[model samples]
Target: MPPFSRVTVIGLGLIGSSIARGVRAHMTGVGLTGYDADPQVRETAKAIGLCDDVADSAGAAVTDADLVILCVPVGAIGDAAREFAEDLPADAVVSDVGSCKESVVTALREALPGVAIVPAHPVAGTERSGPEAGFAQLFHNRWCILTPPADADPLAVERVAEFWKRLGADIEMMEPAHHDRVLAVTSHLPHLIAYTIVGTASDLEEVTSSEVIKYSAGGFRDFTRIAASDPTMWRDVFLSNREAVLDMLQRFSEDLSALQRAIRWGKGEELFDLFTRTRAVRRSVIEQGQDDAREDFGRAHD
Candidate 1:
């Protein structure tokens, strides 16, 4: 059976719409409702049947929901919660899909005091957004990490975990602070590097926009894919998790300096050693079914 029959989702973007569609596909009899701050998004969600209902307001969406998932930028969790705070049922378990957990947990708990807040990040997405961009299979084989507050209800945590599991995500639990620190290196740093590299390519005075587009084949093309992600979400993620992201950025800068020194001195062995280690990491990801080893990172096939 599904963990929650009446599920309400706030913010009908890619993640929110995907969850609603996933629930519809995999969990029969579940009542899924959705609402977004943008009226156009609400209309799109309804047109696509992303949820059973596209509510006109956040409070109306969560009126009788047992599970409420806030799917918004990391910095907007509190504001989204406050939008429907008075309508959330006492037993409704509040959760979120914010990449940064520590700040989101604090915001959710503070905004919806005494409510069950279980922060989660489904480590899965494409370089897409909006209701029309979501698919039911987006979470399949992906990791969904839950970072519940210290005093959060154990039952609430389990229920939220179960909910994600039904959506084909592997559930992992950790503290909010630790989750933030870990994602800083794994996700935030990579996106930051991608954005920087892509921006540099675009701003190069010697390179024309047409030339850059024409020559993008391997590495630059891949970076552009990541850089094409929703800017608002990435902006909020970096700002909300500034401390951890900055820490990782510092480490990345030091490593980059080492690489620069090695290149300047023609240290082939050092470069080869690091390349081999990183290659093994990619192999591990493929072996664990976290990604595909096929061309275009499985994009062409998917």
Candidate 2:
């Protein structure tokens, strides 16, 4: 596939800057323009040569871009799309790296009618945020889910897919609604639980808190690591994907209540069954090569 030619990246945070690196390394002839609300991030990106040009605004970045990627927080996606909607080149394929697909679709679809809007979410991240945290290999071997609307141009979708393929991401296409629901279970609810459990630990009295930190290895530490992710991004994710998150949270709560009941009633067999089932999940994830095996992060407490 031909290089995207001129690609615009709006919001040069972790995902955006990483994509910039991926595009620069893999697509030789492409010209990349980046825009971020944070001036420091823009300057840092420019200093590091992350983009050929750093535009002052989203409109300027998308002026002639063949592919315009909105890589902002989920809530900011609509406004960013609207900012450059009229100026995006006619053949431009506008897409996003927003974690939640359903809300992002509604936002961009209303703003850019004629342009091809391909919604995508790269299923990879670290606890860090901003340009400094981005690396070219962030998308390598990762799942990049694309949610193209039914009326979206096939060639546009293919081109977008091909663009991500160059970034070393495996691609899968699904409806935005399905994408949101699946992510709610796999990503959103887990993040919410992490935040909640970490917050609970933080509220403990100082003496207990110190002990909690010193002895966090039983599993609470894992939650803290996820809870350390950028607050703005996670807040927007929950607010924008409310429906799916709530549905999944309901299911999760019921399961938790069952486990609570098992412990309260001293039901050894029930606890064993639940633990066995959950262990199988870990096994399956590991067999699929999705597990983080090192246990190397157990001590990084909040």
TM-score of 2: 0.95
TM-score, structure 1 vs. true: 0.97
Clashing pairs in 1: none
Q: Give candidate 2's total backbone clashes.
A: 0
Alpha-carbon deviation at 148 in model 1, angstroms: 1.0
Query: Model 2 over residues 35-124: C-alpha lDDT tens digits?
Result: 999899989998998999999987888988999999999999888889988788888888999999888899898877777889999999
Per-model TM values vs. the true structure: 0.97, 0.95
Residue 249 in candidate 1, Cα distance off native in Å = 1.0
- What are the per-residue Cα lDDT tens digits for candidate 1 across 126-210? 8999888889899998999998887889999999999999999999988888998999998999999999999989998888877
- Give each model's clash number: 0, 0
Alpha-carbon local distance difference test for all models? 0.91, 0.89
